[model samples]
Target: MKINPPRQAQEWSYSSHQESIGEALSSPGIRSNKKTHINCGSSARMAGNVCANVDQIRRQGRWNNTTINDAYLTNLPRELVRSMAGFPTYCRFFYLARAILNPPTSLCKKLFPAIGE
Candidate 1:
């Protein structure tokens, strides 16, 4: 549960300020209409996905464009979002469902270091 070490081990940054759960999840500088877009801040529990605009979709084709309506944005993959946010491999899966579903698919996709290695 402790992400940071004790003061004897390592000193915390004085400049670093704690953000609220909503602030931690918000996608700043993104201009979005609430009816059409859902930022990570929209739901406290669902930090796994964030609304991506149409321009973002075209720029990044990794997400499924067909699943969402044009009026609304698409959700990015949790793995990707977590990585971008500098989460470690262990910290990426925030909940049980994501922990259960993501690893197998991710492992299958890798070309080297076969399973159980």
Candidate 2:
């Protein structure tokens, strides 16, 4: 079935490049090492690159007290952290399920016709 034009437009608008970058930077789970910096080509690349650097630090047993965790996580809004955590591959399906099971009526009706079927 075809989606409404306005709703389709809204979805497209929400998933823009800027939004993705914002999501990555604002995520609470991302930990960065202050002493050793990874030079990502741009601000956009820094987020993923930081994670990779953390992995490298982990492999060499160099991740000292700089590891990211809930302590620093509290600096970000809880809701935003929750949203970021939901992006992991393992959590995506569960996130979608939760959204479907308890969505606002307007979104539920618009996204899932079966809800009104």
Return the TM-score for each candidate structure: 0.19, 0.19
What is the lDDT, from 0 to 100, of the residue 65 in candidate 2?
Answer: 35
Model 1 local distance difference test score? 0.41
Task: Name model 1 segments beyond 4 Å from true.
Answer: 1-69, 75-77, 88-117
Steric clashes per prediction: 0, 0
* Candidate 1 structure, TM-score to reference: 0.19
Q: How many steric overlaps does candidate 2 have?
A: 0
The candidate 1 region of ten consecutive residues with least summed lDDT is 14-23
Write model 1 residue lDDT over 1-117, tens digit each, in one string.
123434676764433323222233354543333422243233322322443334464444333445332323335454566666656445434454445555565667585456646
Per-model CA lDDT versus the true structure: 0.41, 0.42
Q: Where in model 2 is the C-alpha error above 4 Å?
A: 1-36, 39-57, 67-94, 101-117
